[model samples]
Target chain A: MFKGKKIIVFGDRDGVPGPAIAACMKAAGAEVVLTVTECFV
Target chain B: MYDPVIKACSHVLIHTPSFVRYGSKPSREIDDSTTPVLPAIETHLRSFEEAVEYPPNQVFIGNLHPDRLNGIEQPWYRHPVEDASRYGAYGEIMPEEEFLGLMKLADDFDLMWIEKESAPMIKKSLQAHPFWNNSDLGKIDAAVEMARIHDKIENQGSLPLYCHGRIVGCMHRHHEKDDALKAQVLMENLMAKASGALALTHLLKKSDIRADEIDLLLNCSEEAVGDRYNRGGGGLAKAIGEMCGCVSATGCDIKAFCVGPIYALVHAAGLVKSGLFNKVVVVGGGSMAKLGMKFKGHLAKGMPILEDVLGGLAFLVTGDDGESPSIRMDSIGKHDIGSGSSQQNIMESLVLKPLDRMGKKITDVDRYAVELQNPEVTVPAGSGNVPLTNYRMIGALAVLRREMNREGIDRFVLEHGMPGFSPTQGHIPAAVPFLGHAIDAIKRGEMNNAMFVARGSLFLGRMTQLSDGLSFLIEKNPGRKAPN
Candidate 1:
């Protein structure tokens, strides 16, 4: 799944991809797009 | 705001039967109310010594197998075999026939079983899902098809029947005999204990390093600290320090999941650059609770079990000396929140930005080692993608460098990257692939610089999650003077 999709957005709730998921998505060509960290008010 | 440097590094070590010698008994816990299970930390440390063939003087930094819990064989999550019983309640115990069938299928198709328990879960889930209810034959047929495809891709070998079978059987029992939520909790707890202990013990064994010498520690694993019911705490850092006799050790957890080790390395490098700490250890423990997950999925797909190993890994990073392969601490790339970028933008920020800052092209580097795991492990999970995420990252980097485009990137990765090599352990996919080879390549003076990258997902908490990462370059003998 890491090919030709010029634009990809990877977002999770707490803003981390556990090593396995990150590696897999990167390998699949997602570029690790964006990481949105939660801010506690 | 941190730069990481690698002064001296150690060879990557692996351990098997890590907690076997601990025996099937619970150790005392700091809290009398909640007893923690002891993981095979000592056994694995001993095995790690053998795997890397390190001399006794090498200082090791890692975690300790918590001495807690009654080594009772909890029906849903007990080791099926006696020898595998020491690592906690979930080292070995899978269904033999089902596991064998999955291995045979993996061998026939070249697939790597990622998680040993995946097969069984798939089977149960599929059986209960509406999709499978429509046509039972279709579901089994789909599983078989997936298994065959996985085998072809991962280059399967003979199955480790006994260990894997026991694991599978235990998992099956967990689901069949216990409540689903309770089973999940128990499984998670066991996995956390095993991963924590393995990584911690392995860290302590490093003679070339010491806990007091390390200013930071990073624990990367698929199992996170928090669950649906509670916030998280009690990671490997503190536990490891206590085990290693370094009571003052301070550290945090880094999650990019499989890519966690790389992230930990980068984080350590950054800390060193910031002058916050002189030494740091990036470590991960094996997930015994996750054993047989892949096999369970395969069984669902009419295949045998494919998982064969259980272990953890650790790396040490120190202030860079101009002479050693230093991790270029300043050359860090990040996908800023405002970078209105697509996937390519994300790739560019995370991969290209750092290279651009360093004025280096992808081809300029000697050999690119990205996610290096055996595909045979993950394919049967219906994850058709090749397991080497790093190779793909390298290929993506090449594309951004104008060497190739999207299609070309795919072709290049397929051509250059190592295929399906790592067991389907969660953190195995991270930069662990390069640890062994990178050290050798640097020692042999074959490569001047290598990149380590790790990424993780934080969405499992049901919050709006995004991927975060860290990257740095390891160079050969930069020749800088040692720190005073």
Candidate 2:
């Protein structure tokens, strides 16, 4: 569904990390521009 | 100097394979069913010798430092050390019988009772340890008859204590019917106190500091020690302190689930930094709830249950002595309530923001200690490798910030991350286990800084959906003069 799409991944340290999400994006034929992992208390 | 430094640390383990059947997960399996027993679970338990030789357990107790783990083969269970000792440089892997004696020594009320036959052996073992004194040895009582123990187990709904498949003692209930004060819960609390005291005693010996020198003690274990009226009312800190002759140390408990140690470390550091206390010790005992948490997987995979040991650790935080590393209080990071719960968000606050403020990058940290649950125990349970996942996440964050090329992400992990060696105990694996190795590496000038990151699953409490996390840096001491 993300084919030909450009994505910016925002991840959590405990949940899905940015790289894992970015990998998923790549797997889905999406271009990843940037990723950031923010801490949530 | 008012800086908070980790003067010394000690890590201990209790080989409580018998107690594994009583863990929350297994216990529930008994209570919720009619069988009241776990079929063939006891057969899979490893003996003390096996526990001592286990590579990860050796790392936990400092017989083998964490850095040495790289040389050891994967599936460490298959590669046991030759002629390993229970006594380690940092602490000891106590036998179940000795730990029970300790539980008796720690008990103030008549909650725990031991069989008379096992008392003498226990006394001899306890006296052989360098940490205890005659006064401490006087506390263990082994005169209780087996009939009383059997009665407690069969009639009073007490929990049976075991060693080598035999009933060695029983823990009695506090109230006739209070579920919160039942023998099982009380036993869990007492185990925490005893294991914690053992670690503290080792800390006193390792640090070469008097127990009375401590001004405050913080209990950061997973057990809740209290009566039914106040179910979670806690004083394990003082209870454990008293057990180890910390007569002058006052204490209380701190709870944030698995992130509790980091939270306690920060609070202890803050207390020392504020000059309110000169010495603060943070301790975490093993969790009964976590033992045998993944036994089904281990049994299915035809491997010995690795979650059979109880872990305990202690750290002494005091003013910088111009030698030991100091905790970088200036770079503390916390997951604010509004930070939002996402992998990206938690990492941003814990790993990025703190380093960002100090003009540092992800690669700057010599090492990162996060959820370090051993892969052997976790992977078979399908939990994946927790520490490896955290390192990858951090590497990903580095890539996101352009601090490193995406192609070098795996290399970053290899350089900065370590293999997980801690047990699957709830709080034990949450980043604090690396403190001992980190301290040594910094003193040896092998590394300059290590960051400890801890994240808690607050949602498990059903209190809120909010997640919790805390991070802090420990770096080589930058000398500062003490006030005259």
Candidate with best DockQ = 2
lDDT of 2: 0.85
lDDT of 2 by residue, B309-389 (tens): 899999999887888899988778899987765567778899899998878888899999988888889889776777888
Please count the clashing residue pairs in each candidate, in the order shown.
117, 17
Deviation of model 1 at B286, angstroms:
2.4
Score chain B of candidate 2 by TM-score: 0.96
Superposition error at B174 for model 1 (Å) = 18
Q: Write the per-residue lDDT of candidate 1 for residues B199-257, one digit (tens) a residue.
A: 44444543356556666677765554443444344454555444445555687777655
TM-score of chain A of each: 0.36, 0.87
After superposing candidate 1 on the true structure, give the runs of residues whose Cα lies further than 4 Å from its correct spot. Answer: A1-41, B1-207, B226-230, B256-259, B300-304, B321-323, B339-341, B387-397, B404-416
Cα-based TM-score, every candidate: 0.56, 0.91
CAPRI category for model 1: incorrect
